[model samples]
Target: MKVVIVGGGKTMFFLGRNFAAKGYRVVIINRNMEECEDLAKQLKAVVIFGDGSNAGTLEDAGTASADAVLAITPHDQDNLVICQLAVNRFRVPRAIALANDPDNVKVFEKLGIQAFSTTHIVSSLIEQRATFEEITNLMPLGEGKVNITELVIGSGSPVAGKQLKDICLPDNSLIAVIIRNNQSIVPRGPNELHLNDRVVVITLPENHGKVLKMLTGEE
Candidate 1:
């Protein structure tokens, strides 16, 4: 995957490193030349020193073929514009924006942009900790309509003893992968779920609740 990050803050700095370590093609854009140089040296990622909200800067960063574009600048308006440029002009498959102001989350969502605010995430974590404890990761996909989540299977989970063919998953939900005992299993109709299995799934956001209920036996 090719990822373009529009920011020089700690978020993008660590994100660039992690993505690069995972073998993704990473690019970093920042308005500060010194910061760009430092990031390039530290991450070994392609760095462009310029305003990411500018179409020309994004073009130079190869946004045309980017698999995912992240707009995490400090300014909410700049983040929105960068995301809009990535989705509307460059046709990037995924555009993610960071909403500094909690109130702008709805505005960004209304415009078909996937936005995340730190305040909301931290608060949600506190509220949903028990319910989502098994979730290793959760990311919005397809502009927030769908979510991809990674979950670890426990011994008493509802799907632990069933085969994929026998389990009735929610509509639009698909198990993308199963990692069991250090082995990655491509899920098939006859594949049996086992305890300690790490599963990755994709599903519509509305169906996420049903999926959790089915997997964890919680209402």
Candidate 2:
């Protein structure tokens, strides 16, 4: 697999290193000469010093052969343009952009580009941590439309001691796995939830609160 990363500071360097470590062909494009020099020295990726939003720059970075293109420039417009070019012009299979403005996420999606908002993600994480302390991990999927949450079943949890079949989960939600005694168990209809068991639940973002309430007996 080949990946092209456009614009970023530490993120670009680390992503390039990680992709190279995974044996993927990594290409990084940046306008800053100093950063490009640093990245070229530290990472095993092809580092090109140029504005990634430019078509010629992307071409130089081999975007045409990239399996995935990620545009993470600080400017939302630049990110949008880079992603658009990668998908529409280069025909890359996957094009992801970073939306500096939360409102631009939908705009990017409407233009057929996958996008995520760092601002919205950070705020959501803070809110989730404050509201649901039992949630160990919360991962957003489908661009924050769906969430996979890990919840620790407490003694007061309504689903504790109940079989999966009897627990009434909200629509578009299901308990995917149960981790007990350091072992992971694929949940089944006959499987029963126990106190302190860590459960991985997949649910729509709208049903996050309800899933927590049902599983942890918390609002």
Top TM-score prediction, candidate number:
2
Native-structure RMSD, model 1: 5.2
lDDT of 1 by residue, 45-138 (tens): 9999999999999999999999999999999999999999999999999999999998999999999998988887676445444576788888
Candidate 1 residue-wise lDDT at 22: 97
lDDT of 2 by residue, 1-219 (tens): 999999868777777888999999999998889888889899998999999989999999889999999999889999999999998899999999999899999998898889999899889878877888789898988878889999899877888899999998988998999999999999899999999999999988778888888889987
Task: List runs of model 2 lying over 4 Å from the truth.
Answer: none
lDDT of each: 0.87, 0.90
- TM-score, prediction 2: 0.91
Tally clashing residue pairs in candidate 2.
0
Q: Candidate 2, 76: how far from true, in Å?
A: 1.1
